[model samples]
Target: MSLPTLHDLHRPLGSTGLTVSPLGLGTVKLGRDQGVKYPNGFTIPDDQQALQLLAQARELGINLIDTAPAYGRSEERLGPLLRGQRHEWVIVSKVGEEFDNGQSRFDFSAAHTRLSVERSLKRLETDCIELVLVHSDGNDLHILEHEDVYATLERLKQEGKIRGFGFSGKTAAGGVKALEQGDCAMVTYNLNEQGERPVLDYAADHGKAILVKKALASGHVCLSPGVDPVRASFELLFAHPGVSSAIVGTINPVHLAHNVATVAQVLKQR
Candidate 1:
């Protein structure tokens, strides 16, 4: 079968007016290798390798890139690597979670949110972030209600610092809440887990965007013990019209190409 390219998988990001490829490049592996949940351990790639991967992603026609402050030096590294090619990518970053000394902490106050965004701006070397998600600590409701992060994101959007904002949440209800008030939500959904189906439904019905995090169960899926994991995972994910993209963090250029090919096959089948 002739495979489709990443450009063929491009879709609109809800009402945000941003277009994204169905396969977004996640950069966690590019920065932090400690305290991760990956099935296998890997080394953080050097600048040369990182640049090659970024270039491969663009060549594959990917446009959305996901990163966060809690992802160690992810934003920092992206700053210089993505400098000259900034216009070709839609950058998605987050705030409210900080990783320090191998420990994680949360701070969602408006002041901290502003500071965090400023730091991200400096680290990403971009004047305005295309999308910003609230990096939730799994306490989705409490953070959505009690914290000032969402309000702060709205203020940033108005100030032209961020074009749009949403939540990288842990619960279906939280995703619903965020979309009802914000621009998008990043949820987890794969063969091993389907609890966030309601969130996808909400997005489809409401014309809001939903990005799938852990769409491959963080590389833990083994459906039926025979299926190609990547193909199976994406077949289910892209089957949904609401999913704008799935963020897969891999430093291997070959693996990245395989993923884009699999997503293309799934789209062709659809």
Candidate 2:
């Protein structure tokens, strides 16, 4: 594909000065199978392919790559691939979840947070991560208010271990709390769920980046029998003025091409 135009690829993610394609890419399964079949599906990036996809993203004008500590080997895979080329884009990682027995589980203890951040930095091969978010779950909304955790994170920021902070979760309340209690610069959620409107709106109004997680709903729409509806949904979300970016992950090169093209169409219509 030719270089993607900012018209189709660009958005200012709040006050971070981290401009990126409104349609960002998330590497949730860069090293594992995500259990969904694509008409032209997504692919988990091998070590070599991770670099290639990132390079391709840059060429295509994408500058945000979302990953999390619970994403298994994704950060480790991205570390080497993105090493010296980190400046080419903004990297987002989460630290509230851990992979245990091949499943994802949450841990919000201050000690766990420190370990998670340290491991994430090592795997991402960065002394300082561009953005680190607390991966939130619905229960225990108080988790975001952990003074010990936020204070530790603030100290890390002061020490230059992280540039910014944020949270990724399923609700507006949790995200809002995170934004208020910490140095949060970004918040992520699934637009299809429509459960975090207030959180995203707050982030948008307050100049914090809002990144949509399941813009594709795990391919529920993309592979649905109704092609027009799928396309319509994509346009509907992309056209939202509040959404700074959407991480629509895919493996098939052609499908990824289709996503970028759809964003172009959405931009044209706007």
Candidate 3:
């Protein structure tokens, strides 16, 4: 079956005034291959292969692309690879977390946040990042209220370094709190995990954008015989009007095409 273009999935990302495809391509696999949570280990694709995968994603109508400093050299590689295609993508990157030496570290301070955004800008080779999310270290409420991260992001937003900002939070309460101070929240919602539904509910009522992370449970969602988990997951996710996009990471063009096709099928049936 022919897959739909991203135009078919174009929708507003809440009240941010940003339009995004229903599915976003995540770039973790393109940058980071070590110490990942995927069920199996795999080789990270070379730039040539990565470029092909990205081209396939764009061809499939995916406009939103998510990456972060923690995703190894993802931000750096994307900077060069997405040069001419910059305007065609709603690029999403993050602050607060860094991956080095096969380990992860967190730094949500205002100074670090500023530096991170600046670094992301240089690495992405873009004048402005469409969205910059606080890559939470699972301390959702504490970071939202007590930390200076959102304030820094707000300042950056005002300075036009970032077009939008939000939190990839751990808990529903944290997601809600992040929304209170930002434009969107990246929550995890899939067939195996629905605990973040309340956050989606709040986003719906408040007209805030929501970009779903781990939408496929990081490829851990299991299905019974005769069941397709991708179709099931999208059906549940898009059923909510608040879901702006679901970020799926894959280095395989076939899987990317299948996912886009599945999204089309689910939306069509609905």
Candidate 4:
């Protein structure tokens, strides 16, 4: 029998009028290799390799693609790679953080936020991004309550440059606060970390989308020998009804397929 794919498991991304696959293809490895926290080092995929991976992802029924300015050349490469298939995916990009010269910097000023979104649009070759998130610098509460980034994102949504806006935050309080004014919150949820469980709970109760980042603990899952880490991770994530999708960044086609199959099995069991 053929393995199940995510195509059949698409669901609503909160009330944003967008439906997303349970697994989102994260494209960081397509653009940058330095400063990443993956357990294993990997060479950035070439144009042909990247194209094939993207094609395989679509065939496996993934519709959400996550990218960010912090991910080096990810946004720019995706522009040409996804040229004609724009409507086929739900694009999630971010503002506030920028990676340059092998270092990271953040800008949450109103002017910088607007500039970042426009630059991402040009780089991604899209007129409007589906979701734009404020990439936090670990100071989630300050960014949400003090910075102009969230408010700027709200304006961008109204101006039709983005369909929805939210926060990729580090704390549960920040996640809940972000959802109070946004459509989604990308939080760290996996077998190793459950501190953000309250964020998932808030999303479930308030009708907000929760996208799981580091779903496999950034490739450092240290579980029991016989316990399948990927399976265990998805089991934890999908058990929560508020999780819209888990963003997994894998450049290897084999890993991608395995992840999809594992998630399919877990969702079926659920």
Provide backbone clash counts, one per model: 0, 4, 1, 0
Per-residue accuracy of model 2 over 1-270 as CA lDDT, tens digit each: 563444445877666666778777788768556433444455566666666777666666778888887776788888878867887767888877777556768777778878988998899887888778777665536666553566667677778888877767666787777666554434334335676778767776677777777677667654356456446766767655667788876655666667776777777668
The TM-score that candidate 4 achieves is 0.99
Q: Which candidate do you rate higher for TM-score, 1 or 4? A: 4
Segments in model 4 whose C-alpha atoms lie over 4 Å from true places = none
Tell me, by TM-score, which candidate is best. Answer: 4
Ranking by lDDT: 4, 1, 3, 2
Give the alpha-carbon lDDT of every model.
Answer: 0.92, 0.69, 0.91, 0.94
**Pairs clashing in candidate 1?**
none
Name the top lDDT candidate.
4
Candidate 1 lDDT over 1-270, as tens digits, reads 654478866889999999999999999998898889999999999999999898888988999999999999999999999988999999999999999999999999999999999999999998999999999999999998888999999999999999999999989999999999999999999998889889999999999999999988988888676779899899899889889899998888778889999888788777
Q: In candidate 3, how many clashes are counted? A: 1
Q: Give the TM-score of candidate 3.
A: 0.98
If both were scored by TM-score, which would come out higher, candidate 3 or candidate 4?
A: 4
Clashing pairs for model 4 are none
Judging by lDDT, tell me the better candidate of 3 and 4.
Answer: 4
User: What root-mean-square deviation over C-alphas does model 2 reach?
Assistant: 3.2
Per-prediction TM-score, please? 0.97, 0.85, 0.98, 0.99
